[model samples]
Target: MKNIIEELFYGNIDTQARGFKKDSYLQKQIMIMSNSEEILTERLKGDDKKTFLSFVNASGIVLGESELDSFIVGFRLGARFIYDTFVDNITPYDDFLKEVNNEG
Candidate 1:
C-alpha cells in the first residue's frame, strides 16, 4: 500500500513535470472520493474494462494510438514491482516510513 502511494507520487510528478503530448497522453486522476457520483457514472459503465479503475500513472512516448497495450504492460510492471516491495517490507507505519525515507 505504501509502495503504491510512492509510485502514485512519482508518476503524478513525472506526468506534470514533462507534460503530455496530445498524441500520446497519460494521466493519474483520482479513483474515488467523498463527493457525489455524477461524473463517475459513465466510468462505472466501463468498469468491466478493469484497467480503467486501477490507479494507473503513465508517460507515453509512443506516438499513434495503437500502442495502448504496450502502455498497459508498462503500468502493470510498475504496479507489480510496487506490490512486491510492499509484500516484502510490510511493517508498522513508522518503521516503513523510516526505511523508505532513509533509503536515499
Candidate 2:
C-alpha cells in the first residue's frame, strides 16, 4: 500500500513538475499531500469521483489554469491508483453478491 502510494506520488509529480523551478510551492504541496495516506484515503473514499471533481473545481478559483491542470492530471492518476488498489484487495463483485444472497 505504501509502495503504491509512493509510486503514484512520485510518478505524477515527476511528470507534472517539469518546467517549474525546483522546490516550487505546487510541487511542495503535492509532495506533502501525496505522502499523507490519511488525506489520500479521505479524498478517495465514498463518491470519490465526485469528490475529486469538487476539489478541482474549488481549487480552480484560487489556482492558475496551468496549476489547476496539473492538479487534475495528478488527481486522476491518484484516483486510478487508489481504485486499482481497492479492486485488487477486495472480493469480486459477483462473488460478494452471491455471498450476500446466500446469507439473506
Candidate 3:
C-alpha cells in the first residue's frame, strides 16, 4: 500500500467526501438548509432572487475560505501535539491534565 501522503498527493483521497452520518445533527441541518434554500428560491422574484443567489454565493466563498483556515490550524495543532509529545517528555495524558489543572 502506498503512503497516506502519497495517496493524498495523487488525488486518491477525498477528505470532504466523508459526509455526515444518516440522521446525524449535521445531516439534519444540511437537509433543513437545502429545503429552506429551495423554498426561498421559489418565493423570491426578479432582483430579489438575484440578490439572494449572489449573497449565497458570496457566503459559500467565505465559508470555503474559513474551512481552509480551520484545516490549516487543526493540522498545525496536531503537528504541535506530536512535537510536544517528543520534546516536552510529557508522555502520559493524565499527567499532562494534572499539570494543567495544577494538581501536581
Candidate 4:
C-alpha cells in the first residue's frame, strides 16, 4: 500500500489540473513534508497532529480551535473506519503507520 504522503500527491493531480495554485508556501511546505518523513512527523506533534488528522477527516477545514475536540472525535472514528474497511483488507496498518512515522 502507498504511504499517506504518496496518497496526498497522487490525489493532488486533480486539484492541480483544476488550476489550484501550486506555488504557495503551504503547497511548498506540503511537498517538502511529503518528501521528508522526519520533517513531516516532527511538525505533526501533539495538537498539530490532532489538527492535521482532523483536517484530513474533515476534508481540510476547521471552523475554530474549539471545534478541534469534535473534529478529533470524528477523526478517530474515521481513522478506525478506514483501518477496518481498507487497511485491514490491504496492507497492515502498522506497516503503513511505521513508514509514515519513521524519522528517516
> lDDT tens string, model 4, 1-104?
76867877888434225443769887888777566755655678898887766665575444455468776899799999988987676653457666778966
Residue-by-residue lDDT tens digits, candidate 2, 1-104: 45866888777436545475689998888778667645665567678856775786677676777777887999899989989888765644558777789999
Residue pairs whose backbone atoms clash in candidate 2: none
Model 3 poorest 10 in a row by lDDT: 89-98
lDDT of 2 at 17: 57
Give stretches of model 2 more than 4 Å off.
1-63, 88-104
Question: Candidate 1, residues 1-104: lDDT per residue as tens digits?
Answer: 45857888777434336554554424222223312233443456565434433432122333324466667888899989989887766555657667788997
Instruction: Locate the minimum summed-lDDT window of 10 residues in model 4.
Output: 12-21
Off by over 4 Å in 3: 87-104
Off by over 4 Å in 4: 1-63, 87-104
Clashing pairs in 3: none
Best to worst by TM-score, what's the order? 3, 2, 1, 4
Candidate 1 local accuracy as lDDT? Answer: 0.53
When 1 and 2 are scored with lDDT, the better candidate is 2
Tens digits of per-residue lDDT for model 3, 1-104: 89989999999988788878889999999899999989999999999999999998999999999999999999999999989977777543456666778963
TM, every model = 0.26, 0.26, 0.73, 0.24
Model 2 whole-model lDDT (C-alpha atoms): 0.72
